[model samples]
Target: MTELPGTYESYWMETGTGPAYPALEGETEVDVAVVGAGVAGICAAWELARAGRRVALVEADRVAAGVTGYTTAKLSAQHGPLYAKLRGSLGAEGARRYARSQQEAVDHVGRVAAELGIDCELERVPAHVYAESADAVDRLREEAEAAREAGLAASFVRETGLPFPVAGAVRVEDQAQFHPRKYLLGLVADLVARGGAVYERTRIVSLHEGEPCRLTAEDGAVVVARDVVVATHYPVFDRALLFSRLEPHRELVVAAVLPAARDPRGMYLTPERNTRSVRTAPYGGDERLLVVTGEKFRPGEGGPGGVGERYERLAAWTLEHFPDARITHRWAAQDNASTDGVPFVGRFHPGSRHVYVATGFGGWGMSNGVMAGRLLGDLITGGESPWASLYDPRRLHAHEVPSLLKAQGAVLKHFAGDRLRPSHADDVAEIAPGTGALVRVGGRRCAVYRDEDGGTHAVSARCTHLGCLVRFNDAERAWECPCHGSRFAVDGSVLQGPAVHPLEPRTLPDEGPSGKEGSV
Candidate 1:
């Protein structure tokens, strides 16, 4: 199935199916009411339920259908040159805390996966962070030292089995990967079997904070609970202005069938515009499929080639390097890039109790999601967790101010620029093919695209949700907002949101080159 809004048709979904959990219908009360039934929320529900606490897990959609379903699913303490940057900005103590917390999380997932007998194909693999440039080698060395100082098992490796060459790399041993959707669906089933309840298709519209927080769904159902965990990838509440604290980045992934000799033993990555990650998943008794993902860009930004192009490049790269490779499945995932370079997994706001938000996983959602669940669970259960200080959302770091400022500036620029002009609605011919242009129609600026086939599409320049001007993301072939990361298709269909409304379509005025026929 092609990629669709709110639906994740991943390779993991091919595994055995599970029972469905319906949405919240009427008033429900629980000891802990978790919002968003992705990994973080489900993990929280699992943990709390195991502790004999009444838990109600609520999801806006099906289980594991959000960011969790689309991840590369690597569980590791290595967070892609994160520790070295953290050491410089947040000091050695901060970096060490971050490493220890995530390491604990990796262990936690392994333990849970094993304990539940989940057939998610969990296994240990060494994660590599490599560099191709001389300067990048130096940075990689610094990061290796930082990782060691943080008590992580990391070292510089001069050799790897990768088909490509690299100057140097850092190996974080004991990392693991699994079928993400399989493990998540298993957890959901286990939670239900253990007498925990979850509500799918129940969107929480508002929350009333008090002794017992009251969560109201769009369908008028309410869940009053002693604790609330907001793990909706990007927090739904704008009260903390999380939109300003982080930026969104979109990454692409593709799976291909590989011969036995072509399979990789572990995960590998390089810090480049086009990164390559390699892992393998079992298809049957003797067949395995390779998973490859890369192509990173700031939200709505990428190379001249977009998601499809990147997928093709990865497939080609695999074939050139591993001769027996064959393409099969492909997809894209988007994650919030925290300004501080670490995930925020604590209180939702200053002086707020009984409310917690988890976000900013930075493409390492597998372990970070567990970290969030465990930490938030501990906090809600009135227990002390050593991981809290490292991920505290209230903690301020001055270094992140620059990234935040730049992101805020860009968003403001787009929002202001969106109101300046109207878009042209006439025809595809007005735009030169292969280029994105802005034009005015009805005194409103909109995005106009002319495809290579000479067909044209015109969409509302103003993003549906916040009125920010939507920019043409040449890479993904979609309309995106610099403000809140909403994505739409070229034909004015909603792809992702913050914006629920599709770009309004307009009819073009008929005109011709010779002034005798309709054009555009």
Candidate 2:
């Protein structure tokens, strides 16, 4: 078996890290508090600050450390067949509105980058949605027509920059790609210059909703904002709005240094079930980082050997296609999807007027995130934006009721199955080094991980967010919640969240030191 690459590092991470910001000192009030400093929050803060409003942007970790850092960075509005789906669900006018919003987002990014003087390697390239099969070719043709009808500069094409011949594709011209982190940090700098505060490592654990929303951090700090934007990918610790509606999906991404000759000039994706997207990032050498991403799967239900196997599959596929490629980085990124296939980017709900949310981008964060920032900023500072009604969070389509119910069913299945089914391991002695499993410890299910150094760690198998069971993600070596996509480290620390709380540790019943087994 060919060995997979090293630890979960992204090509973007190899670049300069985000500038350090001090944690929030104490109680601070702002006009708008933007939580989660990924692309969405950064964009939101940028737009609000640009509007001369006082903003405080807080992050649990560093900026762009979440999905934004790991993205393939395709800044295209041509999300695979999205316009066609939007037309089907939201009618012709709604689809056109959606396209207009995304196009403006691309323009907004360009305007912001140029205004801020950010040299983030921004490039203007075409994006292609191609397919190898005849059935998908038909879908592409229909998709191209839908895109054109919905205000995109799209046309049907026979050939893309792919290594192999594509049967059909919908090519959208003048889309783009860029280094997300650099662009985001540039925004952060501008935010500070405009009297907006940026803080890191300050995790908001509880939100108290009132006339002025008060957020209590894990430390004793408090932030009071007239309005708040819940840009935390999936809205955390929620039962009313996002949790029940959003479906979390984990996707495998691999970045390999391919010869400059084989590098494709256009951002390309397929219409396959387990969709594959191919693009390249300039790394300043003969071997540019060619990122070929796909092999998406729902969490908890096993992959080849967890996500590690998914990376291997990506590697195998890369070797088969781009034989000259040398695999360098392998990582997985999680994305949320909405029942209606349109992102929820407005007020969190009708009841919560002061709170807004931007989630379920369906792996198109660059465009959607920028749109969220622009629309949310407009709604917050100015009156309601024209685009607000199209993406209103409270508006639920009748056709989407079935999708909502279907997603709820999956969550209920995982929540109930983990409680009913027996643990994967009965005895702690069964655990081996560098692996993890759910073990029946003292008649209670606990996740156990044996480190390569022979250290034993255990935590509650149930997720801290919504009580859904967390399965081990071997590729990232973390516990991933199948329901909401929260991830935890081996030591039970929160890695990514909708779950802000870490998994509580559980003591083994009768296990002794030095790998000794005792009776329960």
Top lDDT: which candidate number?
2
Error of 2 at 337 (Å): 0.5
Question: How do the residues 1-520 of candidate 2 rate in per-residue lDDT, one tens digit apiece?
Answer: 2368744687787784767899988899999999999999999999999898999999998878888888888898889878888889899999999998888888778887898899988888899988888777777888899999999999999987887887889999889999998999889988899999988999989888887999889998999999999898888748345778889887788888888878889898885747888888787777677888988888665465666677777778877878888788877777889988888998887788688899989889999999999889988986667789888888888999999999999888888866888887777878877788899766778888888776678898889887888888765678888877788998888888888888988877656665743221
Model 2 score (lDDT): 0.84
Model 1 agreement with the true structure over 1-520: per-residue lDDT tens digits: 1232222246665453666778898899998888887778888888888877888999876788767777888888898887888889888998888898889988987888888988788888898888778678888888899999998999988787676788999988898888887787888888888888889878787889998999998779999998888888877776777778878887777776776666567788876747777777776655677777787766544555544466566667667767777666667788887888889898998978888988888889888888888888788788899868778888777778899898888788767865654453344456755555566655656577767765556666777766877777654567877677877778777656555457887544443552222112
Q: Which regions of candidate 2 deviate over 4 angstroms?
A: 237-239, 510-520
Write down the TM-score of every candidate: 0.87, 0.96
Give me the displacement of residue 59 in model 2, in angstroms.
Answer: 0.6
RMSD to native, candidate 1: 4.5
Candidate 2, residue 139: the lDDT equals 78
Give the least accurate 10-residue stretch of model 1, judged by summed lDDT: 511-520
Lowest-sum lDDT 10-residue window in model 2:
511-520
Instruction: Give the candidate number with the greatest TM-score.
Output: 2
lDDT of each: 0.77, 0.84
